[model samples]
Target: MDLNSVYQRLNTGSKKWSQYPEDVLPMWVADMDFPVAPPIMQALKNRLEHPLLGYSVAQDTLRQTLVEHLARRYGWHVQPQDLVFLPGVEPGVNMALNTLAPPGSGVVVQTPNYSPLLSAPANWKLPRVDLPLQADANGEYPTDIAALQHALLSARTFLLSNPHNPMGKVFDREELQAIGDACVRHDVLIVSDEIHADILFDGRRHTPVASLSAEIADRSVTLMSASKAWNIAGMKTAFAIIQNADLRERFNAGRLGLVDSVNALGLEATHAAYSQGEAWLQQVNAYLQDNRDYLAHAIKNRFPGVRMHLPQSTYLAWLDCSALDIQHPQAFFLREAKVALSDGLEFGEDCGQFVRLNFGCPRPMLEEALARMERSLQPPA
Candidate 1:
């Protein structure tokens, strides 16, 4: 329960930090600067203390931990038999693309999504069906069911990023129901990448499309992990919940063993994080909320031209840098500003004038980052 010691003991082997050793700051990658939960660390260490690390078989304890966590956190009851293990959510995306769609078909996804979903279709020879997120009165990104319905006939699957990656829009239950109805109507499988389901803000909540209705759940393959929340992504383990027995059988038939065997240590860490991480998670969520507020206010007051939304869920802040009249504002931020952010253009042309900022860091680190950004916007001397 003491997080201060864990913070001090935060490892230096993190790719997001160590990759740029001498740099003042590194916020390009999605990994958090904070330490993993003490319980998770202790669990991983205990597993390491066991000399022989062999292939892991899912135990009752691990399965029950996930089931109980889901029931308590989001009210979704996922049976242990309905699970399929994967290395990461990205692998699940790839597997979904490979399994659900016919060879060389289209897959529908909203723009400004995680960059990998855009390529999952292309890499698997599935044509990219772009359903750009329509901006609402609040300027928040939302699922466009109308565009999706129009495109569904030609597409085989609808890849959803619930608690969407960059924008962090936790689609409300109604919005999800509408999207789910559209997918079911089109006979399309809804493969939801719900990696951030546990990261929603105070007012917002993550409603897994599968949990909306039996019809939707039957057609959905919900992907999730403890990596984002617990900061153990290097462990490379994730879970897939597929409800429909027939669909599950078909969907997993194409497994090339890309991620069947997860690290034993990763499993232990996951079990601990899910089973005993409530208090730690509560603190981290509050910290993230503060970070979200700081970034939004700082950007608005310091750089008036920039448009940034405080994510209702994830730690990422999607910025609309369109007011900056540069060729590629994201590239300018990286090269001139020395703040490497994710290029929105990479996610989709629809978000061409945008950038994704990782604000999951110490407050001081984020302050320094925002200051550099403010200086970057200054005119020539």
Candidate 2:
């Protein structure tokens, strides 16, 4: 699939490339620098041949494809009707919060989460309760169960990010079970973003929180997408699995005319990705893992002042630049290294000294970014 090949996205209205100047290397946004999978492109091309691009609905075939995908890949069996198509996961989250959660109720979210998940509660006038995930001695970010339970006391919804963003921590089955059980105990609805489910590294498996048991399924809204894994973010299609009929109905109601139906091309691309893009995905995963390892090694040996934990999933790396004495790492890299990265403050208020680097690019690009960063940190002559 030529995973290492870099395409020029400049002047193509790419969010990643257009965010910075021409000289700057953008490693900020979650989107990849690689081309879309051939299967997805072919599917889009085939759909275009019909000569009609009107408003569309997800076909039964697409639902069946998703159903088979969940069962085959994650061993998570779900009926076809359980799926609710959305334009994007962010809207699904806001919809769930706006309709399901009571007014002024608290929504529990882990700190240092994706910016949208961190802010969705506020969009619906719901209070946000922060449950911080701390990194232990091994540099692994583990959830604090007791804290989570305590936070749930004031909250009716838990916004979860599995194979989490920014930090890239993949929650194991035991951890998900504990979380679901706690939610069940407190009657807190789980709105989980499993968008990066297929992007795991090192033989890791993604477990949908609702997949743990029927009890969890009844209280969960699992949001997923083919965008992240297949490098088709522009398609803007994602789906939510709501096994509980009543909850699904309420979630659909929350769309409120603002959140519209998925586009025609997105549905076709999504079906193609799940049904025929596995081979392409496997190669991408391997390439990302190597890029991750290379980045970790470079940070350790080349930049002693910078620190980062190996991300278990996702192509994003959360780098701690606290030791570098930089007041704002993201801005520092952009100004000094001419490299644009996601600002840490967007993820969490206390994350100002941190920066998230997107490594889903060709090896040469990754190396070039590292080289620029290393040079930026050098002492003046």
TM-score per candidate, in order?
0.94, 0.99
Window of ten residues with lowest summed lDDT in model 2: 1-10
Per-residue lDDT of 127 in model 2: 92
Error of 1 at 198 (Å): 0.9
- Residue 191's lDDT within candidate 2 is 94
lDDT of 1: 0.82
Best by lDDT: 2
Question: What is candidate 2's lDDT per residue for 182-232, written digit by digit as tens?
Answer: 999999999999999999899999999999999999999999999999989
Query: What's the residue-level lDDT of 39 in candidate 2?
Result: 91
lDDT (10s digit) by residue, model 1, range 1-381: 333232422255766755543543576778877777888888878887879987886688888888887778779888988887777889888887787777878888887678888788888878888888867898877777777789898887999998888888888998899999998898898989999888868767778889888999989999999988877788888988998988788778867766476778788888988988878888888888988988888887888778898788888988888887777888787777777777888778767789888887778778878888888888889
